[model samples]
Target: MAKGAAKGPTVASLKKVTPENLASLGVERLAELLVSVAETRPDLKRRLRMELAANQGPEHLAAEIDKRLGSLQTSRGHVVWRQKPAFVRDLDALRRLIAERLTELDPAAALDRLWLFLQTAQPVARRFRDRDRDGAVAAAYVRAAADLGRLLADQDPHLAANALIDAVAADPEPWAVWAPETLRESSAAMAAVALKAARGRLGGAAPSLAVVRALAQAAGDLDALRGSWSLQALANPSVAAALAPQFLAAGRVGEAGEILRAAAPQPTGPSGRLPPPDFAWESAWIDYLDQAGETAAAQDVRWASFERTLDVDRARSFTTRLADFDDVEAEGRAFAYAAAHTDFERGLGFLMAWPALAEAARMIAARPDDLDIDPAQAELWAAQLRRRFPAAAHRLLRAAAAAAFRRREFKLCDRLTEEADTIIL
Candidate 1:
């Protein structure tokens, strides 16, 4: 009240104006602040307008949403990489407004608008998805798709099923992946409707097989799922491998075996004789043999896969299944096989990961020139082996340093050389 007294800090300057603090400023002041803030922040302004529309009732909110959705639908501007962040943020905000806010007031309108948004957004999303290394834009669409699924989950099963059928039938890419969860929450009758609709879309380039398999799995109708796969489809090793597990789980070992056996290897290479090995089919067959009580056959498949592929997982699976002393013997054989493997790098990697450090050391000493050591892997190996296999660790670190030096990475090379020096015997 004194004229010469220093003025106290105003309320805006006294503390950070968080939501709680801003609320204390009272509705009138807050409204003015919002308007001032909205003058510069378009996103916040649009959100406030939507909230205001919502106050007028669902119809008014629905009209605002329709205008927004129509604008998005007509948007033709390509969202370049630099524009992606704002594009994703705005799209996600619209998705949340429809899903979280509008749905509560008018569920049917929300669902319809969401479908419209998805249909409008998917093509643009798919265009950018390939170039989206971090997948921010694609993730926004996934969240939208998942929101659609959750909304469908709340609808009556019959109506929800029809909505799902129509969604996938229109654009199946991202939607089909989320449909199974909705289908899972639906009644068997709903699942049947979904499966039947998917069946009609089969071989029509709609990724309908995925939908069929997903629906059948949800409905527990393995028969329809099996019949859904045409012979052409079954010939693809992955398809056969996929169907085999369901049959095996049902104790139809013969059918499982028959399908796996019927699966043709995907031909590759100049001669076409060297078909890329179907590791999935091999694993499936091992599983089928094991479940059928053919332990010996399963073990043979496991060992063969290990030998042919040098896949350490198959080696582990084989050795784990062997009886006490037999495992030790099998492991010895595996070690020898790895040491003599045609792919020197793979063989050495196998030995190193197996913690056969002595063997790895011997391999390094024997074929140092053949080893292509990753610097990080070499660092880990050196740290692990320095106390015991100093010579091998020295060799690995020097090799990695040499690799780095050749690539003109002087800093990494110097760092590695220093590390290697500490291991000199």
Candidate 2:
């Protein structure tokens, strides 16, 4: 055996304990051993119960599940983060039990059970109050519901669509409303499956506008999909954006554009001041423009969006589009515009990504002395500069080291000092 290896029963030794041996251990001893095992591995107990339930009919298994679910203390009120493990395990176990039971029922029957599980599970999952974990639990139930929806769709799409529509249209309880994004995504996936099935059944006939509206309504909010559109739908750009692709795919390009445009940030809201522009909606609109064969309009949108946000990736994308156009003059003009108007950090990134190293160095040198820059970012720029602009690299590193020392960041100061010395050498 290797050093520090644990000594315990080997596989061969454990294999000696057969069912016969277990049976021979009198009921009391066996029960004690089972309790000990269950105490050590709670999952084993759940599995054991599920295994026992497997032999019974679906009704028995469901009853067992309900009993377990009922026993869970979901109303413990403001669970400490430290106690999340027990709650997570309980919910996960219930989810597994529900999934296992789902496998035994026919599609329609399974859908009913899944719907019930979702209705019950939503409030229970929300009890955690932690957004991330709550979302995760909600996502798990959504996945379960989606899986059932797919199964039903495979058997009978119309039936699946109806069931899914009804589930989504059902008003959410107060607690269930907290995790709307998860619910929306899961419901949307099911709706997509339903729509695909319905389309296939229709066999090339355009789905009636009513059918489209019904599917969209299943996503819980239908203002964007209603026959009459609403500006308030823009408040949830994701919802509006989600509907746009469906419209675009259906060749309703004008309607899609309307949806996106309405969702764009207006100068004023009912309360007076409009909220910030939703980048998601803006990006979606740019995509729509490109798809509509309005290349110049798309480019304008991209540049305008980038200017408004200074989003680095957006800037890079605009520059890439210019490069693709083979317009070197345009690219240079864009770079000059960015350097003059954009923040130094964003401009530096844009120029570096453009591999306009010379321009980047000039920009770094020209930045005002009192302007704050992240030390880590400065180090990165310094390293990049070292390859082509040694003097600039050395200056950046010295400044970074001095700043680190002033901030009492001795380790970073030492590292920067060493790097500066290497540049000098």
**Which model scores highest in TM-score?**
1
Candidate 1 structure, TM-score to reference: 0.80
lDDT per residue for candidate 1 within 146-199, as digits (tens), equals 677677766776687777877787767665566665555456666776677666
Find the 10 residues in a row with the least total lDDT in model 2: 174-183
Q: Write the per-residue lDDT of candidate 2 for residues 198-271, one digit (tens) a residue.
A: 43342221233334444445543344254423456444678567777767776778877878877777667578
Candidate 2's clash total is 0
RMSD of each: 6.4, 8.6
Give all TM-scores, in the order shown.
0.80, 0.65
